[model samples]
Target: MDPNIQGGSYDNPSQAACAHGHYGVAKLLLERGADPFSQGGRFTNALQAALFSESEAIVKLLLEKGVDPNPGNTLQVVAYYGFEAIVTLLLDDGADLNIQDKTHRNALHEAAMQGSEAIVNLLLERGTDPNIQGGAFGSALQAATYHNREAIVKLLLEKGADPNFQDVQGGLFGNALQAAALRGSGSIVKLLLEKGVDPNVQGGRYGNAITAAACNNCWWDDGREVVTRLLLDYGAILSDAP
Candidate 1:
């Protein structure tokens, strides 16, 4: 047996410690020349794996050892899970709130996509861009609306998110109102309408808010009736002509 290959595999000791929640083992590994920031397959590191497991103690231990909390692979994991504590820890450790992944989505975008209101609020407070775009989802507002996160949508609106912000792909791609309408969140739709979002604005595939609602079937139930009434009250066209 090669002396260098004894005990545990040297390359993945940190990851093993993280998986087992053995902070002491992790510390020993770090002392014995383990790389705290080693990225293995899929860009996953010990810190990222610990965060994914929501192992707060292991995460803290890694951070204390100077592991970066906001590695790109880890950011998506934390954001996808709406891990508020980990997110705060990462931000406090100097993680860039505005750093985008390959899809150009920041933490705020991920929080919105998951409808994690607390995480979204925290990110916004930390200066995450509310309107950052990319991904198939569009903006944070659109993500919130798509997920039917009415409370988050309201919060984003209060934070000055553009109700009519166009999706980056163009042709009504990023409209929060369209997202709300598509999800059949009547309250959110009404709120968008009140905020002056055009009820008849044509989204790329859905055409208009009404059509967006109608196409979703579940959204076309009684919930959409209230939305339709609100749109009509605001002078949305009832005509079939685009």
Candidate 2:
């Protein structure tokens, strides 16, 4: 077998083997001196393929055989997809916990969006900054809040995620309160307000939570009113005098 010969237009033999979870075939390719570091399209290396599949076993094989785990997007992809076991293995193998993607999103931000509390905790234990802003949701806490991941949001807050964190990720609105209110997550809105997030705080697509409730036409009035009432209960004094 020609070690470098591509299986077809999309990938080489090793890449194809790894992509299909053909662990034995991949092992054979490696034994025959196939390049473990070969890149094709989105998957930059065979280790990426290994992690993309049933993982643990394949990833372990790649690591033992001396494949470069590389950097940049690898760890972030694994975290984004909620592969806890693989993430742990990669971390143990010295993958950077704070490695950012093209949008400057780290593993923590991905885990927060995915509601993968286990991975979030692992990243935090490794010193991942919860307030680090990037991607559509800005901070990891905002990501969790936007998705109504109440458990994850609370966990982040407990770990010092700023409830009043301003959005710098270019999201329509730049605060967790706006995100929660617009999405009709009344419980999440209450949680943020309880955490001392100012309901009257001005920012985002709508200037404040009151305006966010007024402008979000996606939800029915019943839902919008719930969020509006919650905000008013939190001392958000409204006026058109401005």
Candidate 3:
């Protein structure tokens, strides 16, 4: 039987084996000429499938078989999933930590969004800039604040993430303060404010921090109210509202 034969929900036997963490089967397929680079499945390739399967052995096998560790947001995906060992392997094999996905987010952004503190720390310690803005949240700080990842937020700030930094491309939350407001994360909002983030720095969908808080209709009745008060206390300009 041809090892590259496409079947099941995978593009090829190799992909299926890798996706299911069948290391032995994947090895056999590769040995029989299954192209590790064959692209088509939901994961785009066998190496990515192995990543989804969270199988380090299969990942190492594919890498040894000539899979490019730098492609397909490899580092970002592992960082997002908190696969610390896999992340280390990819980095060691030359995966670019600063490589942004289609959404323009680097590994730091993914780690921040997923609250993966260890990954975040690793990326930071490895020299991943905490403020390479462009993603949906503009910056890692905004992403962390939006997701209420307090520890990650603080970490990024300490590492030189600009609290007032807005993505030059313009994003949904504009700045970290506005992001916290939209998330109804009063504590994060306060943290940013205490860090000296300008509460009136407008640009996002809601324009400013107060407006973002006002527009937050979360399930918790006091969520928006709490954030609004925090924004106000920090001197969010009412004239800049919306």
Candidate 4:
């Protein structure tokens, strides 16, 4: 039996300490060479563990121990969860804002989907591409629209996000307008329409927003009527002749 317990469950002692916010124990483990940058765990590493522990002290200690901040979507995780302090600390510690996760979504996309206006604005201010298209919802505007995050949608639009941007990689929602219509975001739908979204533009199963609303299957009853009227107001052609 070794004094440094490293031969048990996948949960290492150092990681456990960090996750539980036991700062002194974590320091002891690191003194015993417990690999602060250990790869592959629930939180990925001690820094991530500390970050999720909601302890600024632990996070600061890990950073002092030279833990890398941008390891495998850590920044994305913080941004998605709207961990403002954690995001601010990571950014100060040199986390790469443009690092893409498994879904090819960057921090901006995650922030947008989660309706995190503060984090989204911070990312944008730090130079995230507003029109970066590759995630599950294509552009950040499309992501915000899919999740019906109207505030984020408005912010993205104001920052010059493309409304017509299509999710060619994901392919389910297509452009921001179609995605909003399918999910029944009348406000978001109205915003995109006001921004000049071509209603007849073809994409997704419904072909167009008018058809998406008329189908009455993809959307719920909550805002279906409002979206339909809004689309009609924006000059959506019901015939689908395009």
Best by TM-score: 2
- As for model 4, its CA RMSD to the true structure in angstroms is 2.3
Better of 3 and 4 by TM-score: 3
Relative to the unseen true structure, what is the Cα RMSD of model 2?
Answer: 2.1
Candidate 1 residue pairs in backbone clash: 167-174
TM-score for candidate 3, residues paired by index:
0.90
Estimate the TM-score of every prediction: 0.86, 0.91, 0.90, 0.89
Off by over 4 Å in 4: 1-4, 31-33
Q: List ranges where model 3 is wrong by over 4 Å.
A: 216-220
Write one digit per residue (lDDT tens) for candidate 2, span 122-141.
88887888787777777888
- For 98-214, candidate 3 gives per-residue lDDT tens digits of 998887878888899999999999888888888887678888888898888999998999998988897677677778887788878878888888988887888887778788777
Worst 10 residues of 2 by lDDT: 214-223
What's every prediction's RMSD, in angstroms?
A: 3.1, 2.1, 2.0, 2.3
TM-score of 4: 0.89
Candidate topping lDDT: 3
- Which stretches of candidate 1 lie above 4 Å from their native place? 1-11, 41-43, 170-173, 216-222, 240-242
Q: Candidate 1: lDDT of 56?
A: 76
Instruction: Tell me the TM-score of model 1.
Output: 0.86
